[model samples]
Target: MLELLIIACLQDQCREFSKLYDPAEVSLLTCMMSGQSEVARWQAAYPEWQVDRWSCGERSTRAARL
Candidate 1:
């Protein structure tokens, strides 16, 4: 599926990025469900970087009702 492909690409990019910059020195913010999983996996792998998750679904729904 397309989602899987995108995740694969992101994982590859992250792997490459990690080679240059220590993951412990970087901060990542993302909204994709897959991205969250990747961050969680990274936490297990690195255990030192900061990862944050935010959802706008409620805000969007409230705006749609206005």
Candidate 2:
């Protein structure tokens, strides 16, 4: 429902995010942690957006950024 629309927006805006990050997904993760209301809404829509406690000192590894 709303997630699809939000993801579409993210996909469209990915180019902008990718500019600062070689892989824009990093920015996605960081963007979440940046603490905005949208992040919560997004998380509510996608509970799996971030693995439980994934950011607790865990290195991002070489994940393929969507």
Candidate 3:
């Protein structure tokens, strides 16, 4: 439901979606997709999100340091 709308917003590059939904929700979705191969495409579509790619190893290292 909401996931579909979010995906559609990302695919369509809809700025209005941000106005309608919480920025945190959108940020969460973007972060969830950040590790995927489609990340580059999503990043390009939502440059405002400032998405970054972090491999599992990198995440583990960061978690260990914390």
Reference-based lDDT, each prediction: 0.32, 0.35, 0.36
Give residue 31's lDDT in candidate 3 (0 to 100): 41
Error of 1 at 7 (Å): 17
User: What TM-score, over all chains together, does every model reach?
Assistant: 0.29, 0.25, 0.25
Tens digits of per-residue lDDT, candidate 1, 1-66, equal 011111123332432112122234332322334455655675677554343332212122233221
The local distance difference test score of model 3 is 0.36
Error of 1 at 52 (Å): 4.5
Worst 10 residues of 3 by lDDT: 57-66
Put down candidate 2 lDDT per residue, 1-66, tens digits, no spaces.
001112223333322111133333444455445434544555677664441221212224464446
Identify the candidate with maximal lDDT. Answer: 3
Write the number of the candidate with greater TM-score, choosing between 1 and 2. 1
Quick one: ranking by lDDT, best first? 3, 2, 1
Q: What is the C-alpha RMSD of each candidate to the true structure, in Å?
A: 15.1, 11.8, 13.1
